[model samples]
Target: MQQLSKSHIPFFVVLVLCFTPWLQSPSALVLGLILSQLGWVPTNVPIAKWTKKLLSYSIIGLGFGISLSEAFKATSSGIGLIVTTIFVTLILGTWIAIKIGLDKKTGYLISSGTAICGGSAIAAVSPAINANANQTGLALAVVFILNSVALFVFPVIGHALNLDQHTFGVWAAIAIHDTSSVVGAAGAYGEEALRTATTLKLARALWIIPVALGSAWYFGKGKQKLQIPTFIFLYIAAVVVSDLLPQFETLYHMTFSVAKQTLVACLFLIGSAISLEQVKEAGLKPLLFGVGLWLAISIGTLVWLLY
Candidate 1:
């Protein structure tokens, strides 16, 4: 059996700190990134898989804190904007990618990610499009870099614009790449923003199914079976159960609190998965494509929200 070495110590230390009250989402992400950059992350652990599972569980747990009625309200109110932005981002992003001479598969993956739920969308679409490792990794790398930036930059922009909780929450859910970053940025903004963003983001995530299948058809791989994000159903169930069991309000609240901290840890795991090599592998055109597409969606959505 492989044993833990001195190099693994820093990773564990920072990981434990992620659960502490003082370390917030952005700090946890930065710490994890630092650990990876320093080569302190243990190679044995499946950090990416673990991050995905933990994030799913944390999202479901967060559902317990939300009222089913509010979830419905938030989702219903934002359905039009969510649908519109997803299609626009995908179309505009694809056009920009082709114009910039990026690889088709890589461009599509990045565009799907920006259009939907970031890494999740890319992961789902990659297999359908039969993207090779290099292509998939590059797409993920570009999205991750942008996701990290959004985590920090969105809140600052939100405050600078004096956006209210609802406006900022909507903007973050639409503009941010991944659900983790969306939750992190919105949570930092305020509790109302957190609730709004989480619900809207997950609602947006449902589009992954249709988008993935469409990608398979578009890529002439219609035989490929799509992996549905079943956790979304679990998340909805969590909200339902929480709403039905008000007698267990204390327990639900406790789970919600723990889940938020767990999400912080998930961000750390996600950050640890990123490396400089991945960034370098992403290359200039794809990175520029991602940044440009991200900027367009960010600004476009913010403008629509404001006006």
Candidate 2:
């Protein structure tokens, strides 16, 4: 096999990723992970490093800056209804996924995608469970497929329920598995939904820091101290700094876009990591479980939002 330059693949893929319209943050992350794994992009590049640094600055300097700048602007009832829908879906999906024998690790991943952020949640949980690369890849794939469907289906369902833009945005943020999907679905409805959904999704993402740290302590007892993930700290720092300072505002925003683009490139790498020859090894069981879990969340959310 011919050897490829480290920068060559990433540079090429980055070009493609930059041009593509990533509808949501998770979509970009999924794509970035896949491409990075495939040698289609350079994972060793400074993108992740820069993002980490930027995020730290944002969190500290910016003061956990609002992800949903406009979400609070919505009517109280609309936001409450959206929150209720999300919580209900999360409970129902987790129960269903577990009842079907999905591994605890995979179950958490699916639940995170259903309940909070998508790939980020999965990434956070991976270290806690010591999830294999293939398992992570598969979980991401399942989330991606489900999110794509949610993009179209969510808007229609929201419309059918006569939900306003703010209400729909909240629903999209709460129900959609990935941030990108949330943005896409919300944007499909209107600018208000787009803004609200992004904010809501970001707020949900904040939960990962605590969850990761707790999971690390609980699960990493047998492992070496260094094995404990420190990235969560960086992620939190990033959020904090960005929210506190106005001077670094441009830097924070720049990194935000770059992070999203890098993630898209990562998705292509992840796609290559999938062992096509043995794709069926996980069998129909996990796939079926994932499907059922996804449906339960969707149906459950709809019911809560309507009733």
Candidate 3:
């Protein structure tokens, strides 16, 4: 068996710290980025796959902390906004990409990421469009950079605008690309915001199926199988189980708490995957397109929420 190297020790240590209360989402992300820059991330570990699994499990565990009635109300009230924003973001993103002369696949990937669930949207659409590694990597780099920024900036913007928890949650769900960042920002804001954001974001994520199928038809890759996130059904089931069995509320809360910490660790892994070379490879045009699309959605959503 291969032995653990001394160079890998720091990465393991920080990862463990991520599970503790001392390391929150933003800090964990920052630490991960630092690790990546320092070349401390272990090559043997499959960080991307691990991040995906941990995030899915954490999200499902979070369902235990939420009331199903509240989840329903949040989803129902924001259904119109979610649908509108998804379509609008895609259309606007396409336009911006064309104007900026961004690559079609890369542009669409960024737009899909912004319009839907960030990395998840990009991942689902990439295969449908038959995007090459460079194209997919560029798209993911843009979205990931923006997602990291949103984690820190959105909460500050919420406080500055004096937006209530519901408004902030909706804004985060719509504006942020990745579910992890949305949960991170909303969780920092308050419990109500976290619940609202989590429910709305997952509900929005359900659009991935139709969107992916549509992309395949549009891109003439009809044979591509869509990568649907099955965890969402499990998340819904968790909510149902939690609501129905109030007697096990304590156990549910414990699971939820553990899941939240796991999410922090997942963020760390996500951060460690982001290398300076990856950012450099993302290039200027695609990055600009991502930023512009993100700003349009973020500002537009915040204005609608405030008004």
Candidate 4:
């Protein structure tokens, strides 16, 4: 009789367990944290240092998450303009990010955030773009920082313009990067904005599946094969289940927390890997590229959303 390989069992478990409807967000986060931290599962790098830093910075997520949820509940009114905003902004922003010399990976990450759900979009795309852990970490850092800033700033902007909740929702979904941040910003503005922003962000999140498949096809055919991030399905499944259980919908928040923690750990690993010397040695090329692309995407996305 032939025996099953040990690796196959783990693979099967990952595939099956992740799909179970009972699995919650926090559960996934815990699993990811364990796998990333311990040797229980392997990663391209160790994340202990990064995770520590992330924990320190996580107040950003905690504040952003609760506010964002509040915004969604309050803004149950707008729908049409929100869609238009997301479509227009994404196209413009992506073009700008790419034009500015941001490497394809960083450019895509920034654009995805502005165009869709922020950090989640970047997190979803990082692996597909073959981004180094550092690149992912840096991009995540930028998004969260921006989200925190937006939380403080966006409502003021909306108020200055005297924009209605629906308009602000579209703006938040189009311009903001993490859902929590979007929620925070939108909620600050109004409930109409929150609902619109969340719906639009969710719509944008769907893009990851196709993008992942396309990326796998694009990069895998060459000598360097890329693995699709199948774990995203866990996020999707969690969303679906959360939607079905309004009574326990906060479970999504738990997942969000978990994902945020894991991501922080990932960022810590990235920071440890990044050397001041390497940033200097790259002789401004990568820095130029990264910054330029980010600005370009930002401008382009803004144009698309507005025009």
Candidate 5:
């Protein structure tokens, strides 16, 4: 029998890391990076091939985790703030990207990520806007890296300001770029904050459908007509099945738990794929554009939460 390849160790590490949220995903990313440098995994691995499929499946499974009633309540109460923030961030973020010399597609992709749910928003909007792989990768990289930062930083900011749990939850949900970061930051602050932020973030995620369509229309992809992602429908199905079968709450919870774990693995695979070329391709322009939108939502939501 052949001895086990030592290279499998980091791969195993990545496998373990993938089940976590942005809070832990960042660590996976950093470790993946270091392991890649050490030759534990080749930098040329085709991570995107499997990652896209797993990402969609994990998202669909995420529905099993969100109660429809809870999501609806969050939507009803936070819809105004969610809608306004998304719209403003998209328009302003796109404009900034253009002014800073990024392409229109990259600009729109980053804006969608920043305005909505980071990597998910960019993934959802990419097909509609006809974004190429490099464009989507750049957008995802920026949002993913910042999401890692936000996971740790937002909680510190919330505590420093002496904000209450409810206020911090809403602020995090409205401000942070990704659900995991929003949830992670708030979870650090308080349990109630976690519940509130998760509900609001899930509710905010529903905007992906409309935003995807809108990008298609505004960018001329509407000529091919709209095509919704099946994961979106599957996600809805997961929510319905979870709610209607309350007796299976135990099972649904289990399903969601597995899904979160899959997301952790997914992040690991994605993190391993980043390279110096991609970094050069991303450049400072998109980073600055993303930072602008990130700062905008962070400060803007805090102000709204306060008054």
Candidate 6:
């Protein structure tokens, strides 16, 4: 058998990953998980760290895509629902975790993901809570899997219920765990739904800052400084700059699209880092907790928002 060198394989994998045509977040997510399980890549590769940084950059790019003024208009209409659903989900998710004997940190991670922005929320809050990579991975896996299902399923349900574009957009923004899937589902519905959902979801994503600080306080033992997520501020700045610069609109849209694509690559990195040990650490309880909390937010919010 011929021996393959380490340097060449990763470069090729990365190249192919970069160019893969259908490399959306869900696909990238699946590919990453498969690679990790197969043990194809060595553990020493810094893709995980780099991917995390790329994700932050992607958020900044995401800001350029969303006009702050537009976001505020959408946000103003649904601010009460977004805020209430997030806090309620957080409290209920934590309560269920405690009731089921799940890890509190895991509960918080899952809840944060469900409440704010799926894997992005997990990424933002994990460091604040001092969660290990494996812990964050587990929470992300739970949320990512659900986001995939919701991406497709949500549209069907919306149509079945005959929800108006704005209503479905609000419902999706309130219910879906990840921004990508929330946008995906809404985009499937219509451009108006997509616009409304994206704006509302980004505004909802703004909650990550406070949630991270809250995590630091509640989970950390000693006195903790209020560590903020810097990327969020950059994200806001991008939104403002893009909105202000009329001539640069074309470039801004292109960059935002590139940012979303990079985020898919980031998902691949995140998926690759998920070890069996991490999955085992997650266990049945946390998964169940995720399921319960997701159902609560999905069903509960759907009823309240639609009616």
Stretch of 10 with least lDDT, candidate 4? 59-68
lDDT of 6 by residue, 1-307 (tens): 3344663375448536753556666667667777778766565567657766776787778777766676677678888988899899999988888888887888889999999989777876776676755666678778878888899999999999999998898888888998878988999999999888888897887777678777777875565555555776776688778888868998998898887777777767777777777687657877778888999989998889656
User: How well is each residue in 145-245 modelled by candidate 4, as lDDT tens digits?
Assistant: 56677788878877986877876777677666677777888887877888887776655555554554565565467656566655545444554555556
Per residue, candidate 5 scores C-alpha lDDT tens digits across 1-307 of 3344767576775666566444355465566656655667643555677767776777777678777787788899988898999999988987777787888898898889888888777766775565655676667777887888899998888888999999989988888888878888989999999988888998888777678767877888536656555676777788888988889888888888877677666656655665657667767888777887899888988898788
* C-alpha TM-score for every candidate: 0.65, 0.70, 0.65, 0.60, 0.79, 0.82
What candidate 6 gets wrong by more than 4 Å, as runs, is 1-16, 19-21, 127-130, 159-165, 187-195
- How does candidate 3 fare on TM-score? 0.65
Candidate 2 C-alpha lDDT tens digits along 15-60: 4664356434445545555554455644444443443333333323
For each candidate in the order shown, give its overall lDDT on alpha carbons. 0.80, 0.61, 0.80, 0.54, 0.77, 0.78
Clashes of 3: 0
> Which residue pairs collide in model 6, if any?
none
lDDT of 1 by residue, 1-307 (tens): 4567998998998888887788866577667777888988898888766776776677668778767665456669888998899999888877877887888888998999899888767655665566654566567768889999999999999999999998999999999998889999999999999988999987876676567667767777444654445665676688789888899999999998888788778767766877778656556988888898899999999889888
Misplaced by over 4 Å in model 3 are 1-3, 94-221, 224-229, 284-287, 302-307
Candidate closer to the true structure by TM-score (higher is better), 4 or 5: 5
Query: In order, how many clashes per candidate?
Result: 0, 57, 0, 25, 6, 0
lDDT of 1: 0.80
TM-score winner among the candidates? 6
How far off is model 2, as Cα RMSD?
5.6
TM-score of 5: 0.79
Evaluated at residue 157, the lDDT of candidate 3 is 88
Indicate the worst ten consecutive residues by lDDT in candidate 5: 20-29
